[model samples]
Target: MSLEVLAVDDSRTMRDMIRFALEPAGFTVHTAEDGVHGTEVLDAIDPDVIITDINMPRMDGFGFIDAVRDRGQYKATPILVLTTEAAPEMKMRARNAGATGWIVKPFDPVKLVKALQMVAG
Candidate 1:
């Protein structure tokens, strides 16, 4: 099945990487530079899942998750945190903000597709 994904991150390379990884897996990938941009993009598309980085300009992943959750339409959409930070506290914070899961950076493409499927499918 094809999944619609929104990936929010400040790094252009990271967005590209996510696109490369998911596109071949039959996923349609959308990208934004940061959380603020993510919300903007979200207005036009209904994503099956969202992936975000912790640190970003304007709004961070925590705020993004909270924002998405506050919108009733997206309250149950699975959000995955894709970031470099893997501290226990950080993961807890993401959970508190309503992230469905977390994946460390330098991710394996196959694993990411599997993860997206697990949550979004």
Candidate 2:
């Protein structure tokens, strides 16, 4: 089955890259500009996985993860933090905020797809 993915990032290029990577891999992808927009998108789609960036104009990734977890239906859903920040403290913070996994920026398309499968499947 194809996985439905929601990618939340401030960069349009990143969102496009994610779509380019996932679409050919047989996944359905959705995107949002920031955490607040991501939440609005979430209300409209039942995605299997959520991928978000740490830095954004609106509600950053931690807040996004927290907001997602607040929704009962999405509490157990996998949320992956994709960011340029590789700091251990940041990773810990994301985990604490209810993220399921982490991926550094400039990610390999193959690895990204595999990680999504491992978590969402």
lDDT: worst 10-residue window of model 2: 57-66
lDDT of 1: 0.96
Which residue pairs does candidate 1 place in steric collision?
none
User: How close is every model to the real structure, measured as TM-score?
Assistant: 0.98, 0.99
Model 1 Cα displacement at 90 (Å)? Answer: 0.3
Error of model 1, residue 87, in angstroms: 0.4
For model 2, how does the per-residue alpha-carbon lDDT over 33-76 read when each residue is reduced to its tens digit? 99999999999999999999999987999999999999999989
Candidate 1 ranges beyond 4 A from true positions: none
- Runs of candidate 2 with Cα error greater than 4 angstroms are none
Model 1 / residue 89 / CA error / Å: 0.3
* Alpha carbon lDDT of each predicted model: 0.96, 0.96
